[model samples]
Target: MLAGAPSSHMSSSVSTSQGIFPTSRIGSGESPNSGASSFTQPIADMNENDETDLLSISWNQDYGCFAAGTSHGFRIYNCEPCKETFRRDLKSGGFKIVEMLFRCNILALVGAVANSHYPPNKVLIWDDHQSRCIGEFTFRSDVRGVKLRRDRIVVVLEHKIYVYNFTDLKLLHQIETLANPRGLCCLSHHSNTFVLACPGLHKGHVRVEHFGLNVTKLINAHDSQIACFTLTLDGLLLATASVKGTLIRIFNTMDGSRLQEVRRGVDRAEINSIALSPNVQWLAASSDRGTVHVFSLRVRVSGEDSLTQPNAFQGPALFHQNSSSSLDPLISPNTGANPNSSLSFMRGVLPKYFSSEWSFAQFHLPEYTHFIVAFGSQNSVIIVGMDGSFYRCSFDQVHGGEVVQQEYVRFLKFENRPK
Candidate 1:
């Protein structure tokens, strides 16, 4: 039987007129208290030269919100209602990366190279409640990315990742990886299962660290460099895509076994982001080809059962045993089964293309811009583009075809500079 696709009800359009702070203090650098307020300066009214350039965007631990680092400062937005929660315009400089710790006032910030006050080689731990950086970690090299949990902060450098204790900023551990210019790394947010995934020492390999179990497993995910990958909330499953960008593979993180594979397309493209549904029953991928593909996942990771078991965190048996047997028959409800070529039954007789599993549903965007995708409430997929476009689209889990665009908002609009 096909597991039910998760669903969420989101507003179809975001109201630009609504603001989280007083208009007079929009960019005044004053910290506004949390409460109701009027709309401030809309991006549309800002002068072309004064417009803040978007440097980076990332979703919080849960997909409930996302942070946007800009040339001037950083802002946070709520996902469901699609509203700007708050923003800080710092005079010191702009941030190249802004990572939020859930919905709290704490954020991990990396500055753009142009800013002298906040350099590229340092990570600032900002506490909005205090409106100042409480801690900072300076590195010898430019930081690539930052991941934050309540108890720890993981800073990704070009070839080394540093794990630090969140409270005292003490160095806890370090992992050497391949030359990872992108600073690719992911951490599980669940308290019971502390897992981390990053590129292995060798090309096309992934190093999985189960902190709770004190175990580390290496999986050779692909033949090409890993372009993008995402882990489930509990870190029980991993989905990886290589630079080839045509195929995506799902794996059981505990045993380093491939669970299922889904094809994005035959042509090569850069995969920007891969997101797995909270329930682990669906997967989504976005690419430079301007397409977002949703695939129904066949394997299930029993994350819930592990939470209730007494022996859950015992040695290497932390993960539920059901994960290995979760790969049920491919038969789905309305769709009957995952889409495959008619010659799929002739497996060995034909090429791999005929036997490959393709995406169940797809959504297209403008090919020129880069967009990242994440699964949202109620079977909807949330897409954020580099050009300041935000989209929320829903898909049919059973039929698997075109996704319906329910909401679209240009959260950041820049006027064309005078030539």
Candidate 2:
């Protein structure tokens, strides 16, 4: 049996400071200070008071940037150099959630309850270029989360999820789910594939919808209630963690088949987030245990495997492997193998724990703080904490051990500028 209930929506009431920096593309592997003097003023005021409360933080579809919702408004930051690019401070209200669609000017905003102009039951589609809300969607209950894609807008309520066409805001689909206070839902960002995963009506079950194929598959993802899960950009693979938080299982979304499983630890912990690399070669998970783990994926999507290749059923080479010897450019040949227990060879002779695979690399942080993680370019992991901490670390793919910290910054701190 699981030890506890799944976590609910996370929010922090801590103060934050603002600073401006030059806008640059993420995943460049460049130091934050490499070109400091070229920093430009932010689109919004940088000299605003430092007492703003951080309500939430979410990564963009590509993980190249992140949106931070504050009591004052919301801000977007580039991932690589970790600098604020744009922000909006509203006199009327604050945002509780800000979901970005890549780097475009369109964003889906959910307002904090403290303000009345922007209600918690409404999602406002804001276009930064026009500096106004382009559209809005109202719900009967408070919205739990919002997801944005170029073609669709997903709104998550406590017990339902609504999908809408981006162009005309026409309702496309609606799904009923179990009580999900965390708003646990994920959608494929790939242009060709449209897949959505959310909690099913039963505990420990996941409902996956393949819109293109018009198929729905229910996966018994775990024995306990799911705590966290993530899908690859193509939505071909999914990784899930239960409230137990020790084991993370990966599955093929098309056939509902288990592909791989990795262990986070023996003790129980609250999983904060899970992320899969763009190439579907690596998986990362963060927990309340104050650690982030990266594991290598062994499942290969080959054209020969009819059940595993998403491209065989859909269009384009969604996630196909050329050959057994071929490796993704983002992965090193020596690093893909995760460490297995010596007793693993004894197959079925011992308990599952002895035969499970473990993380290839790990990064430590202060325990008790909520964090979200994502893969950055060049085998680096980007971590953002609810306490306003930002970290960039690289792992020795060849060695498979503790990761090296590349950069660390208190992103939400006050900065003094010359008048």
Candidate 3:
């Protein structure tokens, strides 16, 4: 959770949010050297022309900061005080994607923004301390996603994945994929080791490559098609969701063992994103149905074949603890009380909705918006939308009741985004 998050209260009405940076772009007046701000000072009478279309959002929990790509530039904000720490108006047409290198000043940018310093088809590595583009790499096709790890750069293209040496920008290896439109690829690094996972040669299968392409583990995770998948930081485990969207399966990356499964709901819905917490204790999922769910997980880390007992909260931890005693069922259909109650399942199912996983802590959004979910610094849930609205809310382990969410930040006012 962000340090300064206000004490929990039922604040249902989201208030208007003013811009963090003025209209003329950061260089015009809001330079980093600007004097300290006072709370008594009212925002410099706002303006609509000051705000730009927010194209992408990236947050770093380590430093409690996040970055946003706008129509004309990119801006970084500190999470605690919600202050803008860095801003650059490339004057490039626009930035569609901005990938921050954790808390460091290093970042990668690619998108509609095409300029002498940056281009739409290329990823420019920027060092904020220097306030200049340091290194960049271009792709044959439009670049979709860029993942920067300790020593390598992973770039995702429509039908291909590229890995590059971070220091010299040398092309290390490339892997072919099966028409991944969103450019989904995840890299997990730990203890000086790395593993990369993306869609395999087949539709619903997943391929895991350890370090280079020397050793790869292929797991037939689902039947329908992969919606999304995320790996534990150490790359020892992977969680996958298929287009069926109802059930989520966790796999051991080393040997492709199906450890455990969690149910979102029996209703068929589009799964947006799935995140595994640092300790592998919590799993969060978001869907097109306008809800986010967090599930408590239990993993036996003693042995490689140790079973994972998904501790789905129905009433309390005491009741679900018994599920771990037996290894008979790897995936249980009994994700009770938490989500997709039998009644809704009968409806979204017979009516042909995809099954979904129940989040231990579920939050809602306005309908028909594209959103991505992640865990914040303090087990707080962060959900961001493609329309430029983001939220931060923590789950109450005590009540296990309705979740109250506070609006954290807004990049685009409802009226400002182009229709």
Candidate 4:
């Protein structure tokens, strides 16, 4: 149910809305006090002058670093305690830098380009140790995404999915299915299964393919095109949002049963992106109208036997329940399930041109927000804006407000400045 915006009680300790550059060290590994997320210090943001469309930002597990891809090319960085500069720039209009993976010092950068000519479909693997391109291979169609598994790298094109050996980068097995799968995510935490999202196809859509084996499960899911999807880290739950701005459906990743459906409005808003929390319980989805809707399934005790059953009912199907009662009035939205729903209605929070935030909010100036990418066990979110700026953010811990309070710091400023 809707509760009055949680007692607008702002803790004066870490809350600040005035500084051009603010710094705070949060208690790491989940705060015991307010449940707030702590982050590292805000450093310099990677700046670019061109219209840099952010494709993807991924963490390198092997070297414990991070990398990002934009419209023109891709850059690799070492993001340990401090953010390091880009090791090298692989200059190519690698259309949506789909995925970035690091093994030891080797970083495999893969993305899809819409351009028909000039190396139409290819995967580029760069050796970060040598700081040079090691291998580049062409695919059949535009490569949509590439998942780096322990033993294999799964590549998704327009109509086919290829699993290749990670060491040699050689194609092992190829699977063909529907035409244009919009989004692809590896479901298994151990990297065994993958969830393929193909929006707006006819009956029996949405493929759940078990990697290394030839078994595939297809379900007739969603009314319109499946725009975006993400799986829990344990591969227990799968959330799929529609492109038609209706509702997001969460399903059982194992048996393909419809678990819960979160009904969204049928407005012009499109489900742009969806992200699952590191704990694999809560879900955050953003729309084309620039609102971030967060949902979580709370399991209640229905009966005694319900707990032990193997086919346990997940939970009730609640639609777009707002939890902004804990946000400050200054940033909260006025609609949704909360009285202080103003935060979800803010225009620039979900930028039309771009998405991302940096260390400091440019006061008085308009912001172009675009993409928000998150990482790590704690889900450190980096908001990337259209103007080529990115911000690092952690949600407030203690309060439940109508809006999401972002203690963001300027990280990188991309020049997307026209030449």
What is the Å distance of residue 313 in model 4 from its true position? 27
Tens-digit per-residue lDDT, 1-419, candidate 3: 11112224311111112211111222123233233211011233222235566677765423256677777676666554445556666444567778776666567778674544456678766554444455656555678888877587788888788787675555677788888987788886543447899989898989899874267988999998898998776566788999877888888777788877778777788888887765455788888888887886654332112223323210111122243222222322333234444555566555432343355667878767777777665567777777766687777754344456755665445474553
In order, candidate lDDTs are 0.76, 0.76, 0.63, 0.44
TM-score of model 1 relative to the true fold?
0.84
Candidate closer to the true structure by lDDT (higher is better), 3 or 4: 3
What is the TM-score of each predicted model, taking all chains together?
0.84, 0.82, 0.73, 0.61
- State the lDDT at 294 in candidate 1: 91
Q: Which segments of model 3 are wrong by more than 4 Å?
A: 1-49, 61-63, 113-117, 302-357, 414-419
Best by TM-score: 1
Of 1 and 3, the candidate ranking higher by TM-score: 1
Kindly list the per-residue Cα lDDT of model 1 for residues 1-419, writing each as its tens digit: 11111124311111111111111212234444543222122342221234778899899877878888888788888787677767766666689999988777678889998776889988877665544456667667898999998788899998888887665565677798999998899998777778999999998999999888788999999999988888877787889999999999988887888989989999999999999876566789999999999988777544434453322112112335455324222333433245998899999898888899998899999885778898777668999998888999998877888999999977777668421
Q: Write candidate 4's Cα lDDT for 353-411 as tens digits.
A: 12211111111112224444343334344333343334444443223223333433233
Candidate 3 similarity to native, TM-score: 0.73
* Candidate 2 regions with alpha-carbon error over 4 angstroms: 1-49, 302-334, 414-419
Better of 1 and 4 by lDDT: 1
Give the true-structure RMSD of model 2.
10.3
